[model samples]
Target: MVMGYVSGAVVFLVGLLGGVGLGIACRQYWVEKRNRQTREQAASVIAEARKEAETIKKEAILQAKDTLFQMKAEFERESKESRKEFQNLEKRLLQKEENLDKKSEALDKRETTIGKREKLILQQEKEIGDKEKELDAIMDEQRRRLENLSGISSQEAKEMLIRMVENEARHEAALMVKKIETEARETSDKKAKNIIALAIQRYAGDYVAEKTVSVVNLPNEEMKGRIIGREGRNIRAIEASTGIDLIIDDTPEAVILSGYNPIRREVARVSLERLISDGRIHPARIEEIVEKVNLEVENSIREAGEQAAFDVGVHGIHPEIIKLLGKLKYRTSYAQNVLQHSREVAFLCGIMAAELGLNEKHAKRAGLLHDIGKAIDHEMEGPHAIIGADLAKRYGESHVIVHSIAAHHEDVPAEDILAILVQAADALSGARPGARKELLETYVRRLEDLERIASSFSGINKAYAIQAGRELRIIVESDMVSDSEVVLLSRDIAKKIESELSYPGQIKVTVIRETRAVEYAR
Candidate 1:
């Protein structure tokens, strides 16, 4: 059993070994087959990969060639467009060159045309110069021939003719001058009289007789004692306060206020009257009254001046000048109120200026201020006109106004129409009847002056001053005075009166030529 077991075991072992061998072989074979299959698969994959790479390479090459062809085509198209642009630019440049050549030719033609015009103008100028020279030569020749024919030179002949014509003109002018003078005198005299009459008629003014002293009428005799006070203290206080003298004299219930300054005198007068009325005349009361009166009088003076200016239609007077004008309210000239006189003069000046077509306001201003110097003439050394002019100059009055003031009184020569107008207005105001008070001697002398002036003429035989020296009636011999001579004689006498005599208003000279031929028929 052991041996058989051994043989079976051996066979089994051998068979197991063979099986193991076969299994090993089979495993090797399967492994080799799987390896071969894997290698084949790897080779196939490699071959396929190669085929795909070749295909891709071919496509890539095709694509690259197509891209190159497209690039070339695009380059060619761009080059074509660039070449076409260059061609167009070259054509434009050629056309610009052709246009430049045309403009250059046009410029050359315009230059030639301008050159021709300049030459023509220069030739014309030369021809005109030559003609002027030829004409001058001909004129010189003609002048010499004419001079030779006339025996005198042309210049001498012209002078001789001028003298002959002048002589004839002189004779005619002398006759014309006489006629013109006659007409002018007749017309001017009538016009002047008319203006003066108009001024007088238009102005309605009341004449106030000026007094040398301001008199304050008292209520009763007992009031005078109250003004004198104890030991004259009140009177002294009043005077000291007002700068005016209080003249308490035997004037019968009247106190005289006296001072060179009209303003001060006015203050003293009003103060005394108030003191007498109040029945309080102590030194303190007197000073208080005088102080009050001073302001009141000053205001009155200012108002009077302003009112006077307003009435005359004058404006823009200096405040100081207006104050001085107000002081004229208390002043007197030739027994006439200076303020009234100034107003009259202003009105007259305005009227005359309006008639003559002059500046009425300017004339009135000059007339109003003409006598302003008289306000302070009592304190001044020179003429009122000079004093007034100095005041106006100091106060910045216009040159014309200052000159007019200075010349109004003939203190200076009346240079302008304003000065002359002022003078005329002043005379008209003072010379009018009842305008100013005149002494008997002055009146008589004025009458004599009129007669003397009228008789001073050549043709007049007898001269008489009628109408209070306003009219001079002259009797001339019929043989000596023709109708024309009579008119001339009257004008001469009137002119002499104006130039020589200083009368207020104009004097009328009337010349009468009477012829009486009486035959005794008995």
Candidate 2:
């Protein structure tokens, strides 16, 4: 029974061992199948990923090509615009260069013409000097012959010797004067070269707009009708009161005032402005306003003159001259106010005179009064320079001042340093930037030309350019020009004007010869 039980246990142990080995084999097979399946799935996923990556790469390349094309088109468009702009700038530059070249050529020609004129002038001066020397030799010969004449007493001989010594002294004096003049001229020339720059640097002043015409501003368009007034009575009254022509036209909110006299025009402007402001539209009111404005203007003129003199450190001017100087406040040449120009000229003269060791006060005085005649030049006939000189002489200004005034414009030769100094100062003042208006100057020159042409004929005492250069009236000397000759003179003047002047419209020429006998009661 023990053998049978041991065999059964070994059998049981073998059976259990077989079962365990079979299960182990089965588990190993299952694990291998799962690993194979996972490998296959991973391979399929890698293939699909590679296909998607290739599609993305192709799309990116196509997008990059499209972007490059757009960039190229944009660059080409910008380059074309840049080229067009450069071409336009090049054309403008070329045109400007051509204009500059033309201007340069014109300047060179003018310079050559001036050089030729200078050479001719120098030649004429030398000839005149030689003639003067010959005259001097002839006079010396005649004097020697007079000295050797026969019938002579001791006293007479002594007198002749005295005369000889006097003549010798005069000659030496002339030589000394010439030497001094030469030195002075050299010094003055050197001073002049630097003086303009220095004076401009040291002095500066404001300028005024040239008021050739006056216009009154109105509060509204309705004021225009009021200015014209009932049946134009107010307009006529204002014109009669102010001696100015008033035009009420299509211009809105403004009334045009026309007159040649700056003072009269200023008065008219002020009066009209006052009337407009006060809302008084009547003939009686117009006259009252005008008269009041006139007196105020006069007082203002006097005050301006006094103020100018005080500012320039000049004194003792005649009262009448002061009034005339004050009148300069309303005077304008080009765009430069006459009073302002005078002040600037005075300041410049003082500075230059100080630099040259001259009387600064005298120079300033002369410069201040240099253009004084312009204040009333419209009322007088003659060059403003000559008129100013006459007025200066009449008003007890020194002979130096009078001469300087006359010579400043070369109406007479500048015979002294003071006169020359005034000329330089006047030129400097006038030449300052923004001092003049070319158009106004041109108009003035035309009027001047009209008078100058009439005066060029002999025996004409005075010439007046009236009606804005449309008419020229000439006053001939009674003794020099007859009635028939006056007609001929007028014809001659008309023909000369036509030939010499470039003008529009017809210019009427009238010549009058009148005799005046003056008697002053003692």
Candidate 3:
């Protein structure tokens, strides 16, 4: 029974194994068939793709060729049109050239005709000149014959007539000139007085005491000794640093800083004040304070200058120029602060310019900067007017301002009314009563110079500077100078006086040329 069961089981197991093996073989066959089908589909797809590519390539090539043919046709058509245009243009240009050639030939002919006409005109002019010369000779011969018949030599007759005419003309001209001068003086003097009086009445300024040196007040008189220090070392250090002399005298609570250089004196005064205020009297402290105060003072100077310019309504001034103007505060001219003088000049200029119907602001600006050179006149080597003009120009001042400043003293001749106004204002300000004083030596020298200048001119018999050297009366030999010549002589004398001497205002120059018949009186 077990053997039958084992055989049945083996038969069942073999059948099961054979069935599994057959199923595996069939599955492999199906997979291989499916792979073959896929390969075939892929090959067919590749063939179709190649065919489509070839068709597309052929279509593209055909289109390209068609486009090329169209382009060639268009190029040919454009070339044809361009050739036609070129030929037409060339033909027109040739025609124009021909016309131009013809016009040129015609112009050449006209030029030749003009040249002939000019030659003919020149020939006619020469003939006319020849005829004129012939006529002149004939007239001269006739005139000589007429003079001989009249029993008068040509020179003697001319002299007699000229003398008679000169006598009449001299009397008439003198009368006219004197009348015109008198009228002009009458009108001008009245107008001038009015303007000057009006300006003076309008502007009023307080008198300020001018100080050439600055004084720094100390806390006590004992502090003065400390400033002197051991062996006067402190004072020496300050002088060396500032180029100023510190005078620690018995004056209570006061130390005087003296220097010809206003800028140096100002710097020294500031430094000393700082030192006294800080209570540090050592050399190092002195130097530090000095340097700091100097910088501060420099800034103050610049601000003061800028403020002055602003106050006067001037602009475009350089910072350096502003600093220079600030230095004028320490400058004194004739016991008046130069800065104040400049301000006064500026005000006077504005008033004068307004009255004269000129550019008032520009005039005021020029006046304000006119004496700027006084700030550094001691350091520089030239007239303050010229130096100031140069500084104004360098500081970007207008050409008009520079001109007016330069011409304030007539140093370069007044170019405009503004320049003349600047001069007049400056003269008025400086020449006012008690504004300036003249040294006796300078006054005498100036008078001598005036007389010498008048005497140097020809036709001057006696030259005297009268009226406290304000008036120059020059006498000319009556035979040498006529009345008109006397007027001219006065002008020349005035010009020479201006050139020679530096005086306050305008000087009166009188040239007297008088003739007297002394025999009848005897």
Candidate 4:
């Protein structure tokens, strides 16, 4: 048993040693496998890292190259701009130099021309001064020579020559005047009479006297009350608004308006007609119609004046003067319309001026304005001529024209031909027969009857009107009456007419004494 135990222990010990060697071998193999795996992993990670670093370095180098290229392009463009600006500045400087050269050349030419002109003027002035001194010496020599040759001194000779010339001039002027007077009588008088008679005979116009009162034709007796209105409120409104007095009396279908102002009467006439037509004759309506018609009548008056001026060939007259002239349309002088008389005067003046070789325009203007003073003569206190002259001066007429107007009535001295022409034309127009009518026909009849009374004497034959029927020209028998007896008959006829006549102004008692003894030579 002891032997067997030792052998088995030996066997066990060998087995144990072999097993330990195998275990050690297995452990070494496992460790070697793990170390190999770690080495391979580390190699793979190092390869990946080196590849990423190479790509990053390549990107950085490409970015740097692009940046350098862009910087070079910017520098090239900036250099080109700087070169262009420098070239422009060089061109401008060259042009300025060229302009300066041109200005310098112009200045030199102007200075040269000025110097030449100045020298030429100086030479001319010197020559003129020397000539003037020579002329003065010549004039002095001539004066000395003339004084020695003449008998008297220079001043005494001059006076004698002037006196002799004056005497000769006066003698020649007197002879010319005598010749002109003789020639004028032979040619002028027959021509003047023919022209005046022809003009008067050609133009025959009707004369209507426009009174200050206008009559309104009413519809019926009741219509008059309608115009008067309730309690005469209509009439009162018309008079107060129109400044016209309404005369509503017992006369049926006829109302008379009595007013000194014709334009006011005309206004009331129109307003009453309008009210009668409209059938609304209350105070308010009456006031409205009166105002409207008043304006219309005023316009009518202005138009009439304008027409009168146009018809008479007058121009540049004041509107106020025209209005006053229109007012004269209603005024009567010797029962004839004053405005018509003025128009006739203007026409007559124009005709006379044409025959007399005077200015027709100026003559007509004076005649038209001559009685322009008569338009306001009623309001004024004086002879119409002087008042008219004052009005003309106030209205900016020429002094000569005003003088002509004033001197027409001999109120002022007429020193000019124009004044005398106006006076003569005025007299010819006013003094014509049938040119104006008297206030009453009885007055005209009384003058006619007086002339007839003179003709009733035995020696008178062929009684006729002379000087606007003012003076009677009675043809007497030259066989029966002597020159002294004819003068006595004219005085006796004048004394008889003066007792029978009622005249406003003085009438001339003209006794034309003429004795023509009839004898025939066979």
lDDT of 1 by residue, 1-522 (tens): 899999999999999999999999999999999999999999999999999999999999999999999999999999999999999999999999999999999999999999999999999999999999999999999999987887889788889999999998898688657656766887678668855643432232322113435789988888878777788887778878987677778889888776556677677777777777788678888777777877888798899999999988888889989988988888766567889999998888888889989999988988888889877776657767899999988887899999999998677898888889999899878767677556456778888878877776676788898887878888998997898787777767776776566554456778889999989987
Which window of ten consecutive residues has the lowest lDDT sum in model 3?
Answer: 200-209
Estimated TM-score for each candidate: 0.48, 0.44, 0.44, 0.47
Best by lDDT: 2
Stretches > 4 Å off in candidate 2: 1-210, 437-522
Question: Among all windows of ten consecutive residues in candidate 4, which has the lowest summed lDDT?
Answer: 200-209
Candidate 1: the clashing residue pairs are none
**Which regions of candidate 3 fall more than 4 Å away from where they truly are?**
1-212, 218-221, 249-254, 437-522
> How displaced is residue 305 in candidate 3, in Å?
1.0
Residue 240 displacement in candidate 3 (angstroms):
2.2
Clashes of each: 0, 0, 0, 1
Tell me the lDDT of candidate 1: 0.82
lDDT of model 3, residue 350 = 99
User: Which residue pairs collide in model 4, if any?
Assistant: 334-437
- Residues 206-290, model 3: lDDT tens digits: 2112344578887888898899888988888888888787767778899877656667777898788778878879887888778
Candidate 1 deviant stretches above 4 angstroms: 1-212, 379-381, 439-470, 473-522
Question: Could you tell me the TM-score of candidate 3?
Answer: 0.44
How many backbone overlaps does candidate 4 show?
A: 1
Query: What is the Å distance of residue 514 in model 1 from its true position?
Result: 9.6
